[model samples]
Target: MWFRNLLVYRLTQDISFDAERLEAALAGKPARPCASQELTTYGFVAPFGKGEDAPLVHASQDFLLIAARKEERLLPSSVVKDALKEKVEEIETAQMRKVYKKEREQLKDEIIQAFLPRAFIRRSQTFAAIAPKLGLILVNSASTRRAEDLLSTLREALGSLPVRPLSVKVAPSATLTDWVKAQQAAPDFTVLDECELRDTHEDGGVVRCKRQDLTSDEIQLHLSTGKQVTQLALAWQDKLSFVLDDKLVIKRLRFEDLLTEQAEQDGGDDALAQQDASFTLMMLTFSEFLPALFEALGGEEIPQGI
Candidate 1:
């Protein structure tokens, strides 16, 4: 099985200057007694936004570190490819700034033109010392699942499933009912339940839910739409119960009386997009880290709007 942990983090305190140092560490090998290795430096090529003439102001100092290894390669191509793709997206957005000022913000023409057929984008950066290197990486003091551990756990769990999954959309929403909704439609289906793993105190957090109690109005919303699902149970304070549906979880849920032994299962891929406008890496580790960090920074969580 192939996997690596992506330690996405958000910095706690603001880093003011364009960073040339950390990149070295991420991309370079360790320093020798007589000579120093080159520092790895990642760059924020450009920024773009809808209806903006010039690129929206963006911090150039921020950085991202992707820790990944393939089911095959020494360095996970997933990380390298993901990084390269991001750079290209940034470049395209930067190149398309002018068209955005016009009435149509999509810049359809730019999208068509940005990728030159013969003139492919060749991206390679070289700088001496200080960037995220392939060896000895440091995370922003916040990481729970590395790519390897997470993917392995997922693979084994999937193997044990009684049946295989077919794809569609909308498996679940709201983290509370993840278990009950993962099983449905032998060949194809979607359920409505979400996973809210934001680390914080809420009146009705999953902590309050009885895993055996998958009979909420939210869970039944599926039956209303001609779908069937087996609700997985959750312990009040358990690790993320994604796939694998840990039998231990069932055991505990049984003890807590949360499982209904006679239900079916159904669920699938989640909708994920880069979380925020800024690229502060540390807080990105936790779903709630950003919101909490902002408050600590004296900024309230403002709802996005015009």
Candidate 2:
């Protein structure tokens, strides 16, 4: 359960549900398959897709993952529209009269219904975890819409989930630009070899650099042209390396050397043991990283039960 991208949010209110309570709530509305007429369906499911009927909410000691599963039919709009048009034309030709707009729309709906049953079904799962101790919800998806969809599913299951985008008092662009200018990293962070610089104004341009020295003259030229650092590659205390964006989403996260060490220690066998060790390692690391990140971004403490 490694996460490549992070869509993070701050839980405005405390969630104090024990494992049993959360499981019961999720069971009340489990994931169901998409019906013939339904285009899409969403609900909770197993985090790792383990077991026949995996628990709706996978709860560990410090973390709980609420897995959201969505099944959608692959019915192309143009295909349906073309088929409807052809059918409408056949009917109009038979009667020797042009079909009205309302009738054409009705035919379109009918065609969709007729084809819905034969449409291919696509399934997707997105996982989001709640660290109540940290008062944060971390989504594994990079897409904001997907993350919001998962949050909406959680809201339906739990009745309510008060959350907001994590905000920091300091301007990320300013801090990042300063770091690049000084050719140094922020406190507790080490600047890496990738970054994205963009203009702060509307319709501004962007420059992306990978595996290039950020302190080079070319990057300095962009900075001189009022292009602020919107994203930066950073290594946090040598444990985690990722691209931290202006939006505060961490992408391309790499747990340096941990996986290698784990594999070597386990002799690269026993998949289950490896999974457990990796999960434990990630949980331990993030428990420290999250709060430290929040502090580095000039975030204030969120009072309990707010």
Total clashes in model 1, counting residue pairs 3 or more apart in sequence or in different chains: 58
Clash-forming residue pairs, model 2: none
| Candidate 2: tens digits of C-alpha lDDT, residues 110-209 | 8889999999999998888778888888898778899999887778878998998777778777778898999987578889998999988999998999
**Most accurate candidate by TM-score:** 2
Report the lDDT tens digits of candidate 1 across residue range 92-209.
Answer: 6888743233423234334333422222232331111112221112222112333223223322422321111111122222222343444331111222232222223344223222
lDDT per model, in order? 0.26, 0.81
Clashes of each: 58, 0
Candidate 1, after superposition: displacement of residue 131 in Å? 15
Model 1 stretches astray by more than 4 angstroms: 1-17, 30-306
Q: How far out, in Å, is residue 80 in model 1?
A: 32
| Number of the predicted model whose lDDT against the real structure is largest | 2
The C-alpha local distance difference test score for the whole of candidate 1 amounts to: 0.26
